[model samples]
Target: MDKAIIDFFQNFTTSNHFILNNIFIFFTKIGNLGMIWILISLLFLIFKSTRKIGIVSLLSLFFSFIISNLFLKHLIARPRPFTTYDLKILIPLPKDFSFPSGHASASFASAFGIFLSSNKKSLKWVVITLASLIAFSRIYLSVHYFIDVISGVGIGIFCGYLSIKIYEKIMKNK
Candidate 1:
């Protein structure tokens, strides 16, 4: 099923130069290192009101990095889809293992941290939407399986929730 879904997107990417060229590929590339989300988190930190969530966002990113990149990816050691299948990797090939997509994990972890720590509903939606697209881009670019991104999303949201809980508890005690 995961291969089937990746094949569908790979076909779509090869099928239309316009959409792939103008949009999806760009997103997949942009999400490299979670740079896009990191930029957003930085902007959030610039504002006084959003500063708390911004801190949470960065914390979540940190936790996601250690958990997904440091531990889970090494432990799972899932092969990249492109390695297993004959597909053009749309971006610079990722060197790390693929079980839990670091892109998906970091993006969602930071975004959900922002969402859970802040009261701004509109910003939450924007962050979540971008995170969702980034997660999709992993599978779209042949760097990950659907299940990898799913596991990432699961890890990300959990980390985000845990960050907020810990932050709130520390603050409450202080």
Candidate 2:
């Protein structure tokens, strides 16, 4: 099923279509190590109104990293789809276990964390859209399986919710 899904995406991509490949590669690059999400969190930190959300988003990203990247990746020890199969990925191959995509987890963690803490619908949608793109790029790039991206999204949302609750509790006690 995983291979089938990947092969399906392959139909949309061709070696001649460097433009499309570059676009997906750009999305995947921003998601690398959650750098873009961290930058967003830091930008939020610069404002007093968003400081709490910023902190919470950072915590959410941290939780996602620890759970998906550190623990589950090692525990499952699943190889990247590119390693397991002969898929032609758009970006440089990643050297790590691939069950539960770290990119998807971190992107959704920060996006959903901000969504939970902020009241603006537009901001929420924007972040969610970006996160979704990042998650899909992982599969589009053939770095992760469909199940891995889906599970990563679930873990990310859970971590984001957990961070929000933790922040609320801390603020209430203070």
Best by TM-score: 2
Estimate, for each residue in 44-116, the C-alpha lDDT of model 2 and write its tens digit.
9999999988999999999999999889999999988777677776677899998899999999999999999
Off by over 4 Å in 2: none
lDDT of 2 at 55: 98
lDDT of candidate 1 over 1-174, digit per residue (tens): 998998888876677666664576777777788888788889889999877887888889989999999999899798888888898765778887888988889989998998898787898898899889888878877789999999999889988998898889888999
TM-score of 2: 0.96
- Model 2 alpha-carbon miss at residue 19, Å: 2.7
Q: Model 1 clash pairs?
A: none
- lDDT scores in order: 0.85, 0.91
Report the error of model 2 at residue 163, Å: 0.4
Best by lDDT: 2
Show model 1 residue runs off by greater than 4 Å: none
